[model samples]
Target: MEQKFKRNIGWLQGSAMTIGAVLGSGVLVLPSLAANMAGPVSLISWGLMGVLTIPLVIVLAKLSTLYPSAGGIAAYARQAFGERAGRITGCLFLGTVPFGAPICALIGAYYLGHFFLLDAGGVTIIALGMLIIAVLANYRGIRFSGNVQALVVIGIAAALLASIIAAWPMVRKESFYPFAPNGWVPVGTVMTVLFWAFVGWEMICHLAEEFEHAKRDIKRSLCISLVVVNLLYLGLAYVTIGTGVYLEQENLTSLTGLLESGWGRLAGSIVALLGVAACYATIHTYMAGFSRLVYSEARAGNFPKWFGRLHVTYGTPYRVLIVLGPFSMMVLLTGLLLQLDMSILIQFPGSIFIALYIIAMAAGIKLLPPKSISYYCAWLACIVCIIIYLFSGWIGVYPPLLAGASWLFSRQRIRVKNGAISG
Candidate 1:
């Protein structure tokens, strides 16, 4: 008998759910950051990121088309190379969970704090609690998780569209006159941050095992999600930045600020409520994906069986969720106790994931067979990614080096002859 995995996910369910996972509070915040760095001309950075991101997305699409296994990039790399390479990919993949998931929880909590007047410690406590609830919801079953994701994602997209529509007429034409006030450095920095925004395309590939029709649906879902994400991002930028709202107010850190300038206090608060809901949805999305990563690692023997086993009735990795909840709670408490901004602490870990993404794009492309278009696009993608990587300000991520060293020390080293990591 063939071993079946999570089988309820269809194209609509998968695409909408995947988009929910990818889009986050970044949408609420990144526009101002981009505009601040490059003025209205920062829209150019959107084009640049789309250029870089599309090729990588294509490579991932090709890989998922070829191999729709739950292992995701780790499975693809392992088939091309060997166990050693696979382990490295898996480790790097797992590493992002620690930072990314907790960051989402803390960020969502912060926004909720804006309304409740929660202190930093109180917000952290609430964030940790939210993380736990999100994880538990997943542990209940994939059906509940998928349904909840679909609802929240639909709400998120609708809320974002409503915000843009409400604010469109208020755009100041003169605000866009002095574009590029800063320079390209901030352009690169903001792009680096936005890089995280386009990240979850490959994550859906990991659910290749879960989707009912893995091969065709996986590729379709990924491409569809990519197009949808790009469209939303571009639309929001025009509504918020093209109108000169960013220039006048100089803040995109919250929908509250954007809405107030574009609309009135009543409308801004309404949008903020939507933003908070979107953030919570994002928080759950983070836990769902990160829990799966834990399940992936545990099955690989890198972690204990406790992490691998699913809940008997729900068929979800309950243990992994349990463990992750407390750890993220600690992150919340520590962030509160030390009075640290979640973004500051998150930047380091987030950079490492971005590095993994660049490497995944490069490696994914390099591993393809000749006579295929993806092979050529992969190398081109790699070169572009390397350029982005240099400008990405992630040279000292610390984790990749330590990770690379650990891989080198434990077994055979990947000989980087002529700048390629190979055996």
Candidate 2:
């Protein structure tokens, strides 16, 4: 018999897990990105994004109650539509994980090195070191690593809340004077950038197989998680705008420049450190849940059956961990070596991910038989997403569409046997 992962993570651990993954470097750099893209109206767009995401969260949570499994969105999609549709959802969901994990790792490393005032390539080396440790810990299994995750979540949240509050007095009210200075084009562009800030909320339900009493807890956890996250997000946005409007109406570039101006040469370094920590936490959690999903896929025969194999002592997928670690390191090096702007590189992928999510949620709600009419709210969610995507512009929207399309094509190969889609 195949060994079962102990269903040990509960509501609190589960919530921490999800929030930790989503809340990462997003909070740190958002102020800068919002400044660059939306001016002040990104707040409005944010509210829209929050409202739209709620329904999909509800659907995922509801599914957790009825069909709690590691396949997550994949399983939800399968049940609602059919085997091929479900497989498409699964492939899309899993495809992004490997790509994202490594990049996030390298990004966090860049920050780590910066915090220590390290020289060129210092960030890359530190990031790789941290990532290796993280990979080893994850391969050791959740039971051993749960406490560390909990601490990272708590520490990161506390620091962010404190930073936002601490920066409150710096607001200049007039900063938002020329809201949308570049006009609607940038606002839409930033909306796509901000979408990355909100991407990982569904990871909890995807890891549902590990939860205890998943039905009741999943609902409680998602609600609590989103509320906390939203508040933090809004608080940061307010600080950025209010502070900017106070500091003579400059755009994000100037505003960020101002963040360090009062302090001189060492200016903004503190915030920079915070940004790196946030990235580390976010990247760490994303990889953990992502690896779990991959391991689960292997078990279900959706991946190379070999991927399902586990380490003898830790009961983790040692091979997958080994493969993914170096991949993220490579991306990190490419980004830093090229001196790519963080905002441009990171924002585009986020926009693409959001587009993919809109489809996944649509597939889940439409394909599944509705338990209630309110469940139809998912279509509203999709409409909201489309608006955000359009506002974000064609550049931001097309990549994820192509990615999800690729995943859809991969499903065509799965053999249909006895009314079941078999990989």
Candidate 3:
């Protein structure tokens, strides 16, 4: 018998999950990266990206209400375009978690090293330790993890809000001069990069079926999460650039530097701890979503049945969580061993997510009834996704290549099965 998930999540948990997932290490690092890429004009990029996400959010919210499932985006793709498209969507999603989890974990770990004066070895150990903790939290089930996420999101929001308030008084109007020093072209470039910050909302979709009132609560959560995320992102961007700390320091350390400049070392340390909590929230949500995705695929006969098994006592996908934990650690360890920059790993998943967003938006258009509000929103969202993909440069190419390979393998398997049946 196939096991099922309990709908124990309410609007509060759903919103917290969305906010926690969306408010990851990006808040700590992206402002400086955006400033560097497009100068203070990246502020415009931040606003633009946030506005563009509205259509996508509306479309996803509508889809969730209509077809709520643990598979989330993959299920929508499957319904619109058949099994192959759905499997590809699921594969791409599952592919991202191993890389995304470590990338987020390392961000938290890196900042912790700065706070504690830890060496690379210490940081690597901390990263692995954090991954294990996240896996354990998730293995207990969504109800447990969801409660943790609510508190985590509150801490992160408070930290970011405090930093913004402290920095606001120090803002210089002079920093606005020469806003587009790199020209308007880089705004588009930075928009693609900043798109990483907007990715968590889609991730929350995977848990739609777990909502107490999927139709009402999912849409309500989406709206609230988006508003909260955009306010924090814009506030952080303004403070990072307006205070001019980002202009003076390395991108990775700029957020810490900004907080320290205003509120001293203690403030920086507190923010770093909050950053670690934020990263864990993201990893926890991703693990939960990815396990369900794997379970969804397995239930559909796309993956090995072992992955579909749930723990009898905990009622969680323990097998998938157990497998994912070590796999994520391996990625983190390999990166540490190779001395690879975290940015490379981060960009790989960001690109794949862009591709997934495109697929989801198209699926929304096809699956929803035509001439409706959602239909138009899907069209606009699809266009926005394409524009971002075009600006994503070489970073955008890898996902399609991966999806094509997956498609080919899925097709070959289908042919073999047909041949066996015919024989």
Question: Model 1: clashing residue pairs?
Answer: 171-243, 172-243
User: Could you give the C-alpha RMSD of every candidate to the true structure, in order shown?
Assistant: 5.0, 4.3, 1.7
**Which residue runs of candidate 2 sit more than 4 Å off their true CA positions?**
36-38, 172-189, 245-269, 310-315, 330-352, 367-374, 390-423
> Cα lDDT for residue 356, model 3?
85
Full-model lDDT, candidate 2: 0.66
Per-candidate count of clashing residue pairs (backbone under 3 Å): 2, 13, 0
Query: Which candidate model has the greater TM-score, 1 or 2?
Result: 1
Q: Candidate 3, residues 177-224: lDDT per residue as tens digits?
A: 898998999988888788878887787788886888888999999999
Model 1, C-alpha of 230: deviation from truth (Å): 1.4
Error in Å for residue 257 of model 1 = 4.0
The candidate that achieves the highest lDDT relative to the unseen native structure: 3
Residue 322 in model 2: lDDT: 77
**Where is model 3 more than 4 Å wrong at Cα?**
none
Cα lDDT tens digits, model 1, 352-392, are 65566666666676678875777777777777656656654
Q: Candidate 3 at 20: error in angstroms? A: 1.6
- lDDT against the true structure, per candidate, is 0.69, 0.66, 0.86
Q: Which ten contiguous residues of candidate 2 have the minimum total lDDT? A: 246-255
Query: Whose TM-score is greatest here?
Result: 3
